[model samples]
Target: MKKPVAGDSPASSLSPCEIPKSLLPIFLKHIAAFIDSLNVVVLARLLPQSHHRRILTASTSAVAASLLSQRQHRLVLAISTPLLQPPAASTRPLLPPDNGIKKNVQGPTFMRKIWARDKQEAIQVEFNDLGQPIDEKSSSELAHFLGAIARNGRYAPLHYKNWIKVPQTYKKEMLTQVQEKFQLPPGQEDWILKSITKKWRNWKSFVKTNYYDPNVSLVEQMKNVPERVHEDQWKELVTFWNSDASKRVSDRNKVSRGHQKMVHRKGKMSFARVAEKKKKELGYYPSRSTLFIECYSKGETPGNEVASQAMVQNRVCLKSINDPTQIVAKGIVRSIDPSTEVGGSRLRPNWCEVHIQVAVEWDEELIRRYGMFETIGDALGAHVAWPLFLVERDESDD
Candidate 1:
């Protein structure tokens, strides 16, 4: 007769098949070894082909040895009869069937930890002498602060063109609140005030566009006013909207908007964010020309005729400039003082005094480079052709 497997023993007359307590430890050890060897073989398959042969051989040997040892001890017991038999109803306790829902006992602890971490990070943020945070989080926080002020009805009717027209007491209160919350330096008071004023104006415009309807009567429009705004303030806003002066201003703005040739396709993305994204992609901050092209162009082509001409002119200007750094320095100075004349008759205010000096300098340069011009205006107009080059020259000397 064929020999039975070591684990396949005849039924004992005394009791059910149970491993001896003394041999239980040894049985578990062998089972663990067998599992570990199988895991090793699985891992071996993932290794390089050269290492696989050696690793698999060692694991297979271990598996075979563990099986042999287990068989000798009859540790791989098959208690098939017990597995097939059902437990007595009285022996097993009655319990409800499990569904997948679980209680979130650790939720409060997790939220507290998150809050603490955010608080710690906020404390660690650094700021410049100007009170501007060096980190991006502070920018987001400032935006949130401005948004809160914008949403508050107490600071409504931001119709004044100049920030100076706002009440002094209100400005002081806002300044004090900003200083307390953001730790703003005294130097940044003007900047903070301007930012707040701009936000308020924008919020006012948003409310007017989204809530007010000119077709509806003043009373009907008043009903649509935001709950945060007082009824009196809403009536004043409606009165302003219906005024002849406001209508004239609106018509002028529509005319000015129609003259705009280039549309900003970059949407709401700031130039800073665009530069940052480009830096990540290209592994460095892009040059002004590269940034302009990337931002204003679609793929290889310029977005519009104006952008196309600007790029062509920029290339010409880059060639004309002997020292590129001068261009950057002059650009910075021009930005700080928009009244600074830059070799163009753009009819800017405060340009008369600066323009005379600029014209004289350009006249000499134009004569030396491109022969004589008919008049100072002719020389200045010629300078505009190389707009990027002549604009950088220092004409600060009176």
Candidate 2:
């Protein structure tokens, strides 16, 4: 006998019609039951009505008979329910239908283009051979130059671990670059250098605060280096930041900051801006005390006890100086220039003490010539004040 091949298996040889008569009904019933068990409603909802009808029409006679007998009610319900009910109202708002041609949308890119154009127009400046702008006094031009230097690899001051430790050559080079870009006055170079140093220190502090986590490993922290900083520099910084020395120094500085009593609420507004505003409002520049009160206090009272006490003392001193009984000789000198006096510039008007001898004879000629003072220290030049006590001592009776 020939060996049975793979396709000659008993099950594979049996066709649908070749199955035993008794089991044929059972097989068809099982197949029909399986079709009925399926989520036909979901399928009917997803498919078009024509396709759903075609599926039912294509079924074998035996299976169809079984389906009609067992699931006739279900088939009618599934098919009719979808047709009877309208589709759920879409929650989303209707957008304008898309055309074949794509239109250019005014999004971030368009806004960026507008901003770039505005910035270019706003910061227009003529550059010299050294690439410095002609308009040195223009703050916008100066800001542009500074921004360029910050991005340039040649300016190494910004990358230094410690600004104080940065070499003088690097600082001089940066100053020279700034000078070449703008015509800086003689003493203004120092101011520029100081400003740059402050910016660098602030940037480093920002990096330490945001990126340097004490709990994280140095290598891991270095991975999160700021885009402006070099990887090697950031690695070194992270290593240093992780050191005990850095932590100790940071803790000490934090403690020192905590001890500070009088903090200003002026925010980013500088004293110069405050003075300018006050000058505009009052028709003259405000005194340092007035500026202090404006910066550190709300209304007339100061924020802290120390500042409040100082303000009170200041008022008392001013009142006493203005009193006729406390008046002594005036116009003894043509003018008192605080800048010319030794350590005179350091004195504050409110802190000064004045000892008056009410019993002693006043200088009649001096008092008559000067007349009553309009304001305390008004006789003195602008920004000048008597910060010391004037005690009258008589040598005739002694």
Residue 316 Cα positional deviation in candidate 2, in Å, after optimal superposition: 16
Q: Predicted candidate 2: what Cα RMSD to the true structure?
A: 22.6
Which model scores highest in TM-score?
1
- Residue 175 of model 1 has an lDDT of 62
Write model 1 residue lDDT over 252-323, tens digit each, in one string: 988997855444557645455567678789998777655554555554343644433332112221111233
Give the clashing residue pairs of candidate 2, or none.
132-181
- The C-alpha TM-scores of every prediction are 0.43, 0.42
Clashes of each: 0, 1
lDDT of each: 0.46, 0.47
Model 1: runs farther than 4 Å from truth?
A: 1-134, 156-162, 262-300, 303-305, 308-398
